[model samples]
Target: MPDAIDVSATPSDLTLVQDEQQRTKSRELSRAPFEAPPAIPGYDLLHRLGEGSFGAVWLAREKRTGKQVAIKFYTRGQGVDWSLLSREVEKLAVLYTSRNIVGLLDVGWDHEPPYFVMEYLENGSLASRLKEGPLSASHAVRITRSVAEALVHAHGAGILHCDLKPANVLIDGNMDARLGDFGQSRLVTEMSPALGTLYFMAPEQARLDGIPDARWDVYALGALLFHMLTGAPPFRTPEAEAKLAQARTIEERLVVYQQVLEASPAPTAHRTQSGVDWRLADIVDRCLERDPQKRVANAQIVLDMLEARDNARAKRPLMVVGALGPVLFLVALYWIASTVGPRIVRTAEHELLQQALAGDAVSARILASSIETEVRIRQDELVDTADWTYVRQMIRDSHQRTKDELSQLNKGNFPDAELQLAFDKVTNHIKVLEQRLAQADRTLDESWFICDAQGRQIYRFPDAGKSLSESFHWRDYFHGRGEELDESVPHDKVSPRTKTGVSLAYLSTSSSKYKVSFATPVWDEDQKTVLGVMARGVHITDLLDQWEPQIGKEGRPDDRFLSLLETRGNRPHLLDHLRIEEALKRVGTQERGEVILRVSPAVEKALETTDRLEDYRDPIAQLDPKFDGPWLAAFYPVGNTGWTAVVQERRNLTLEPLGQMQGVLTRGALSAFLVFSVLLGVLWYFLHRASL
Candidate 1:
């Protein structure tokens, strides 16, 4: 081992060759309280400032420089190991020139009270500041970084601040940390064990025979930082203290301390504290590792990591700006392209709409004419049935007989044979009318019937024997008007609202299909007075079949289709394509009967304006509950009837070229974006490699 002697000082005064027991006894004897500050030559002691186990520190002034300094005096008594004082002074002298270390002014070994002077710091120590409470993260980190720098200097000088803690760190006038009080400092080659504060010492260093290592200071630095952040040391919980109190000897207590740190979970309160980021927490955790080898190698590496953290923080704002600039530019370009593309699409859409409307108008007119022709043929046939002499005679005879039978029925008398003969005659007459109606070229009539002038059915072909209620007076066929009466009118007051009529379409409960009746009044021999009425009934689905094929099929909104509208009343009503298809399926089959058509606001608005609509939009396509999209629509009147034919073609299908253009533009933009992304990625990869 190298001799513990400094050549600059006297050999007897500077040499420290004492053993461990003698040094312990010297520290005990040096703690003797002094009654007054001891005077030292070349330095005037002002007053006693603080005291430690080995010495008392006093405020003093240099006579030559008039500079205030702190002097630490070791109490001289019998059996004192003067080597203890020499060893501390030797370590301090080696680090005196460092900015992070306290400067040693002079040493007075032969004085009555052996003393050494150091530069006086007005700001005191970190332990005094810690009494107020935990510091802010920024303040704590700054202090910690300064202390770490001081450790870097001390470690480089082969001296370990084994007792490093807040009390050992003095703050200068500038508020920077200067590590002081190296009384327990050990050189790298020293084999003697040194003890440090309990909670701040590493587990491996918490032993009586522990040798001084750089890791011990590393652990103490972490504990110091932990104290500054949380206002308390790590693993200083009540349970740990309870176990520590049970140990009787220093060796046992040290063993308990090691076991407590090893058994307890790592400290995390620092991590959860406000402003304590993961990077700082990680540094503390690595330094406080239970395994000495796992701890940070030295304080210099901790200083470097803190610098790296600062560098990362400094680049954060620039990184955000670099990323946002390109993203915003691409967004602006995309917005401009979208605006221009839609305008071009709308321009082509307007021209296509005009052509589609013109074509639909022609189709509507043709379909209306065809429906009118078919309806007129059926109406003529109905008029011919009413013109038959026997038809008129039979209706008058049957109405008279029904009135007489009803009179008898009121009196509780059974209908007579004469009433039975009258019904048979009307039945034969209806059968002949049915044959006549069947002979028509486009015979779509479902049934034929005769009614009394009072609107009571006398007979009906196909279901002549079915007994119906006396509720026929309110039927549209009997009154020659599309609307029904709330109550029946008297036989004497019964009159036709129209001479010949095509009644509004109605849901037939038995068939589940809509039916419309064409009726003509049967007159007396003079052809001036009405006797009764003759009518033919036809399902609405049959008429739809005639015009539906002339338009397109019922599929998507874009498919063309024909809608027959009744625009005579408070609102127009049209048969839904889906409903019409359902009715067509039951034409010759049995199914649940339909009750009524629910009025749709879209259908009403579309057909309400006029019997002849030109260049109109299909409101049902645009505003219906499903929002099917716009269509080019045209309406044409079916003869003099209140019915109108609406023909429509989807506008999107008509302007298909616009969709193709948009698709091409979309593909081009996506391809460009992909290429730009690939190029940017390649550039970034090259730049990253070059930087490495």
Candidate 2:
């Protein structure tokens, strides 16, 4: 270049420099002043609604149509390119006829800053509603249904609302929902990187490389529903990046949504509206299901379920009233019988039989004048001869005499026979005197008569002389082979008897005399089979008189001692003083028949060790050989009889103590009602202020 510059090379280098300068000048000219698109003549911009990274929305009024519209301006200087504006405008135009989608009314390329006008909505967006608080279940369902319907339509139209979220849904004055912002929407046929709000994007979308599908809209809808119900979007944390990482897994996103639902309080509208059912809550839950496949396939299914729920709720009040009416009537009848019926029967028995028997001159006067007088005189004579003090001193003296005699008998290897004889004489005398005193004090009353198993009258007491032949029969001792004597049969129809001729049945012997009999079976020493029965027959008049005093003034039947008797013979007699035999007889059948199991091994062992065994309370009821009912019975081996004593009551009646506790519960319920009323008043006042 210094040596007169190779002329050809110099010329080529100058041409290259001119071409580079021309290209720089062209770029500068392209970047120079672009006037904002001339506002379509008469159209006027009012106020800005929002501004974003790519565009700004301005409320505008159309001069010709006199219509309000949202003009979205995409200024190249404001970080938007021509391509993005054109794509968004095209998507909006395509979705114009969709009821769920916002429509593009017009576009202006005449403006330096290209813009498009969309139909204006006044009620703002779902995101704004969520910011106030969670929506009620019904409102949440309604919004979700609309959004899903729009997604279904979009998906069918070969489009995906890749950026679906609460912010993209607009509510109008009538609360009608519409979707907006198709800026990020893509044709389903396109293969592109995922682009959407991180929190609302499905796991597949969060991957940044997967193809989007209808499920993408499903996941976004779930996220939006979660926000509407919980007042916060799922996976939205203060640490944005960390929260976005968690949203990558479908399971993790679902867990977040579930946690929000569990933590959220039930809606206030539900608490205030008594007629509103809880089934609406189920719809919200279904929409928010983590698995896109599990959610209603589309909005139609959700709408169908909601309609069904509404119909069910409408019928509930009438159904409840119909069911409760019959229950209340039955309860009233039971209460009357349980409380008042027993008292009436007890009063009738006392008035008719008890008073008459106690005042009867023939029976009472005979006992007072003859038998009782004889017993008292004999007792006095025995005491005069050997008072208790004298008897005690004599016993001690005889003990010493016997000991001396025994020592004398043992003096040699074989004691004197005479000394042994002397000791035996003193012991025999003492035994005889003891027997005399026991007999004198017996003082048997004539109110009832006693008999042996053989139907033999045993020293006829005053009432015992009524009859020994007709009243005391062989059938009375041995439960015979009558139709009522079947072991599998219930005592409802069968009268039980003891071998002692104590008839559980009311036997009409003489014209005005009725007897109530109680019997105990007499068994052999081995206690295997019953040999006879020991019976006590009381004049019905006298027995009723005795029971009257024990019956309290409350006038209820005394259910405590239910006297029953059964025989141990081949036929096995059964009897019940409570007169429940009629009911049992009516219920007689194989299915309802009684069953008897032998005593347990443990119980048999206990019996062997003790002569008199008393099990006051048995946990398990022993079935009668001929009756069914849980009975608390006492078995006593009377002489040689296989006899037992039974007393029973219904199980529910045993819970009398629990019934008394209802008063405390009633008071607690009253207190809770008062508290709830006060809380309701406070809530109403606050809600009124909130509405204002």
> Mind giving the per-residue lDDT tens digits that candidate 1 earns over 396-487?
55565554454343233535655445545545655665577457534456777777777776656655444232546666777765675566
Per-residue accuracy of model 2 over 1-692 as CA lDDT, tens digit each:
00011112211111111123443553454355333334656688877676533445777898988888877766543333455457667777777778888777888866767777888888877766666788876687678777777776776576777777767888877897888877677775455544565456664455444555555666677677667767766655455434424653434433443454345443233323322356755654555554443444444445556676878878788666634454443444456457654564445433323222221211222222232233234334333322223222222222233333423322322244544453344334434544664575432222322223333332222332335322143434234322223334433333323223233334334422334344444444455544333333444333333323222113334323333223343222233333333333444343222222234444445444532222222222233233333222233332222333233233223334344544554476457456555665676788799999
Query: Best-fitting candidate, measured by TM-score?
Result: 1
**Residue 306, candidate 1: C-alpha displacement in angstroms:** 0.3
- lDDT scores of the candidates, listed in order: 0.68, 0.47
Best by lDDT: 1
Candidate 1 lands at a TM-score of 0.44
TM-score for all predictions?
A: 0.44, 0.37
